[model samples]
Target: MDFCWSPTDPVIALFVPTDADEMQPARVSLIHVPNKEELKKKNLNGVRDCKMFWQSNGEYLAVLFNQFNGTRSTNYQRFAIFGIKDPGIPLEDFELENENDMIIAFSWEPKGQRFAVIHALDQRQNVSFYSVIKSHNRFQFSKLVTLEVEQAGSLHWSPAGRFILVAAMRGCGGDLIFYDVDALATLAIERFVATNIEWSPTGRYVATIRTLSDELDVRQEEFQEGVMIWSFFGVLLYQIPRRHFTQFWWRPRPSPSSCTQEMQDVLEVVNELDIDLDNDLDNVIFFGDVDNEDTSFHIIYRATFHLESTRGLGSVVDRDWTYDE
Candidate 1:
């Protein structure tokens, strides 16, 4: 065992890095939160490595493991899914049939119905998708796509099982490949692509971090910041400036275009409402660039609202002076 938990599974996780036999066997384990009694089993997957395991569903315990198929890891660099359910009890897995090495990187579907895996094939990249069948107790290998030397890169499935976004960095700069999973074989490609992609929570937008450096003139390092907000159909909505690492809304509710009147006629009135908890004059807002060099500076946008004390100013004074009503 090249890996063991430092404290316990409760504190830090333990990894084997490589199996005793395969050295690195594309390992993955799921600790499906089980009943307190059922959680104590150590040999369910022919391994007692996990601190606790539970059933993600009625039939599966989600696992994360360190196993390499001898393709990527010096010790164990590959990860996989193992079903810790019935008959075989432990190590009972739905292995990738007729494959030498398991894919180095993979992602599970949001709904947990499917997962996507890309593997090493013929000195090339091949992406394979697996659909989870709960009733049948198996993972159905559904779709497969193969690519050349540098094609099959930056592949990500949408949050739902709608489509997959892939970037192929082959001959030219690169390409964004969109494959509609529902349409079947309908592929759309966007030229000049980059990586580190994220689809918006609403599933309408995609964000990717890309370096805009020159490929040939690598020494001419002209680094700038940018963020591209793209639509589902690959339209450039806007490439916002990355000032202070700005964030763009990937998916906003679709609405009619904004008009000039739609912009709020922001009414700002500044008056001293002297209920001064901490010199409530501080609550008085100045709208313009009224920079007081002594105490205040501009960039104070506006004062919207304030809370007032119920006590009258005269009574709150608590002084010896008497006033006639």
Candidate 2:
């Protein structure tokens, strides 16, 4: 089990299993990080494995749990939504179709109240989409779409929450299926046997790194590592082979304030000015004579002003241009 923290709040959700008593059921704990106070603890009787997910807007928290049925001997996939302001009351509790269905994959939208779940049922897998809704001061979950996939690996949502990537690793020789969330239709598919796939921070690109052997399994003896970077629209950006390639990461883009076109142009001008100033200062030092004993001395004063456009303030820089008799 893993813990998930709210994106815009100080709340976290985690699952705690029973220690020794067979009568005691597992509990999911919602805690406040700053004060370490548990806001709510909900009992899960037959939950074996679970995951915590928070909505990007920080309005709701979802807990996906796999419940074990000891009588019929099967797994049940269920999800529960809790209100952030009132953790004690559950907003919604939904169970997938068929109690024997197994939760193969699940993911939440990166920036919205929508989520997707893939489960195995009736000898095939189905993908279901659900979104949170509010009705008369209460929250409700509405099913958006349910599509069928042949063989799915994992679920990944785009940073912009516009598309979903369904990775197929085992059956189809490693393929990625992209789906449009708004249209609820298939967009594109790319076949690549990748051990890991990561989305760029800015949601512009995704990198798939090869770390597995031809059998689609990770092993130490496997060589001939490779990587493929692709755009969000399924365009192949770059591909290369590397030796002993363990990991690769995209540089996180700076905030909008530091990445605007105007800011970039200003930075370029400042860099050029700095280079020119350095050259001019070097020439001045080489031409100035320190050994001359002249009663009358000439002093050159140079001032560079730094303007903070956002704050409307200016500061001066001293470049060691003072001379005395």
Candidate 3:
């Protein structure tokens, strides 16, 4: 339930219990809110499929949906990026194409220059890239790449738009593939069972959550669902339970100007093996140099959506413990 705002308009996500239909009538709050906003029948028209991308500046959004007419056709091919000249009035809009199927995944190029779309077409999916180019006294889509993928379950773009991550479902034997967008070379391939995927902001790690374990049904054979943080080369770095797969956030490298020679020395002195990032130990980590006169310590901001709680052996057993008289 991630709520986002595009300039003036705030869009809240609506969930569907069945059919995987985005237009199942959900609510829209005035501003982007994480709380429950039930969709009345009137607001159903504004809700569209999952293929929605907010422009880089957050001034506009591109979405696809069906209209009010009784005679219906394919999903709305083109949608306007919601902008606002007046409060609550959806402003700037640009219609692109009539992509026949549902648009599931999309990426806006870094620096708001272009965007890419991935549409679900049954077992196969369509990958289309677009650039904003001058045409007819306005900008038109310059299709850069139009390709197809098999069993395409997920997609992601590198920060600089240099690559795209594709995950495919091939029954019990599926593959996770990475490709260089420009050179068009296969970067890496992996076989970790994944339910969801996200690339780190710095493009150094690809985080994936295994679906089977998240459901927590032991009777199900594939319930070892876990989260794996992998290097760009497909090497696993950190692994946790699916519930531990929280947000896809990366620590920004501190600028050289902000770091003193002492900070560098401290890092060099601390060996990786000596330091423990043990989740099982259940310790709260605070990363910063309070004594550094010129540096700012990074704050671990806990997202309100998933406020994590501490767990202990006693905490677990106490809840289920009982005394026999």
Candidate 4:
């Protein structure tokens, strides 16, 4: 079973796969939260797996189904779009021109009317873009463009939209491509053995992470575990090597108006100190207070003296201080 919540509405979508032994068909349902009502329910046959995607505005929901051909022993893909806000919650079914092509990745453009899919056939992969168009009070899906990509298996869209990062990860050789949707141009192409890709909340930076597992052989050079930070245009900003690195997360930032006075004061002090934690170690001078009783008083005195020294009243204070009791 899998479920997803609508970003902008009080709706939740649920999917339960069919059980061959129990003789049950796959099911999908949308539930309205506040009123505890069932909005829509759909049953499907021959489905092996289902994935659900909600548009940024919660206006529509896309369901991708992977189905198997029992006779051919092959798998194919189909997708359905549901107009959540429309009357009766209408749904439209769609499939690729080649039914045998398997979809490897899918993404909805942030706050936009389009989505992209990476589909593969016999090892050759291509990324296709589609737009959801509304005409005559009905919604339609239109294919925009399809581009052949080298081992591309995943898509990461910028938070603010317009840019996308196409990457080939794990067994796919770790190739990276940054593309501009509006200009139909490739911004930068690079390589990294990334197992995961993330875009900064502000859409200004991207982080390609390579995490290693014990089950995989780590003797290969490409299996190095670390994180690489890149600019929106794929410029390499910083690369930090971490042993056994498994996870990465971005810190959330609050708006300027939400800043408290204490927070602003801390920022001012940090800026004034101008400490370079990574490179200023050589200039650090340590003052140690060994007596337990006078430690606090000495710390205050030393801090005051250090601040005065910065103004030419005494010698310059070191960036570090040590206290012992």
Candidate 5:
């Protein structure tokens, strides 16, 4: 097995990179979380090594594999989709159907049912989209559209699920491609080969770290070893140079946006009450008196007034103090 994890579900999806047979069909195993028992083992459509991906929502899992016929010199690719709820069954399984095309890379839109694939046809690569649908209580997958792109690498969707970045890795000599899902428009910036891509949690910025390869020219080599931050609209925001830089990551944001207004109001009221109680304690005065007895200190009365409260609630504490010296 190459990799395995629970992408958001209780069941674990394990990807076996290759099969025992000479056909080398990629296999995936779905195991139950409670007993660690294998629920289903599925053989994919294509024969060569495969890559596994899961949608962020965990509703769908996709496997992309390459196929080659002995009579043909070109490579062929296909993808299979499995539903998490029905691990034993495939939701959608088929080849690309596009003539002489191979799927290079694909990515799921974060928290969404839509996904994009980078496919190569006639030695040209482009972007294509697919969406999950339900009708008559049966789930189905449908192709939406395709966009022309010069080359393909990896695809990354923003945390907000609004934007996607197409990374052209080292030696591809392709620029960064940014796509806006709602608008169905793409923007490309020239002269960049990204080794790694990271999206800010707020979806405000994208970080692309330059990849160093033997194909880089002297001019490209001079500026190709740094981190560049770009806005979602494909504008160059900033870049930091470091030849040895390897990775870039953004921290996960908190859930403050999901907090309701009423919740915020209640939190504010509680905070105010806490501050009022603290202030009242600070104002409390401590007084002690020595009694006629050999060893005794007496507190005749103690009062605490909550000045911050509108009702001005006050309490009195009284006790006799006696201690052996």
Candidate 6:
């Protein structure tokens, strides 16, 4: 079972696969969280897998299903869009013009009435943008534009919308393309051998990370595992090399209205503490005075948090530290 919650509403969309031996069709449903009521349900056959994507504002939900053709030994894809806010919860079905073209990635523009799809055919990949258009009292998705992108495998939209990062990660050479939707122009193009890409909550910065796995033997000189921070415009700001790096995450910032007076007071005190990164012995609090080299310690440092003055400012610092498992 696969499920996703609506960002702006108390509705959850779920997809349950079929049991082939039992001859049951796949099912999709939307449930109201408060009342535990099912708002919509649909059953489909020949579906091998299902994926659900909810619009940022909870206006619509798109369910992509991968279907198999046993006779032809081939696969195709189709999608259904559910209108969440509309009465009766109407659904519209759609498929690609060329059903044989495989879909590589899909992403909805944040708080926008558009979505993007990366489809490939015969080793050629293209990114297509579609807008939800309203005409004659009904809404439908209309193709806006399609661009051929080399080795594009994924899409990452900014939190504020308008800008999108098209990247080809893993074995695709980590090709990065920053595009502007409003201007319909390519902002920048760069490359990094990243396994994962993520945008900052404010959409000001993006981090491209290269992580190492325990099972694989990787040459350090060939694939330097680390994190590279870049601006939204595709400019590399900083690159930090970390040995055996496994994961990276951005700290979320709460809204101004949610900030209480007590939280602000604590942040003010935290901002006053000085951080000295150069000296390891100074300004460091050791948990135990054990002289053994294997002993682990927790060190706290004052870091800067990017926020308004009224909200207070502090960030968690990441450093090379040994910890007990």
Q: Which numbered prediction scores highest in lDDT against the true structure?
A: 4
What 10-residue stretch in candidate 4 is worst by lDDT? 281-290
Model 6: residues with Cα > 4 Å off, grouped in runs: 19-24, 69-72, 213-219, 266-325
> Taking the tens digit of each residue's C-alpha lDDT, what string does model 2 give over 22-50?
47888888888889998877888887668
lDDT of each: 0.41, 0.65, 0.49, 0.74, 0.64, 0.72
- Which window of 10 residues has the lowest lDDT sum in candidate 6? 299-308
Ranking by TM-score: 6, 4, 2, 5, 3, 1
lDDT of 2 at 82: 84
Tell me the TM-score of each prediction against the true structure.
0.50, 0.70, 0.52, 0.74, 0.67, 0.77
| TM-score attained by model 5 | 0.67
TM-score of 6: 0.77
Off by over 4 Å in 3: 1-4, 7-52, 68-70, 73-75, 81-99, 135-137, 168-174, 214-224, 227-229, 233-325
Best by TM-score: 6
Cα RMSD of all models vs. native, in order, equals 14.2, 13.7, 13.3, 9.1, 16.2, 7.9
Candidate 6: clashing pairs of residues: none
Q: Model 3, 48-80: lDDT tens per residue?
A: 443445665554455544433334543455454
lDDT value, candidate 6, whole model: 0.72
Stretches off by above 4 angstroms in model 2 are 1-4, 34-36, 69-72, 85-89, 170-172, 213-224, 256-266, 269-325
Which runs in model 4 stand beyond 4 Å of their true positions?
18-24, 68-74, 214-223, 255-325
TM-score of model 3 relative to the true fold? 0.52
Could you give candidate 4's per-residue lDDT for residues 1-325 as a string of tens digits? Answer: 8999999988999898889673988889999997879999888777867999888888889999877666637767898889888888888887887888888888899889888899988878898888888866688888877888877878899988889999987654756989888777889988656778878777778888878854443355657676787888989877656666666555345677998886686455545665442233211111222222344345435533444354332322332322211
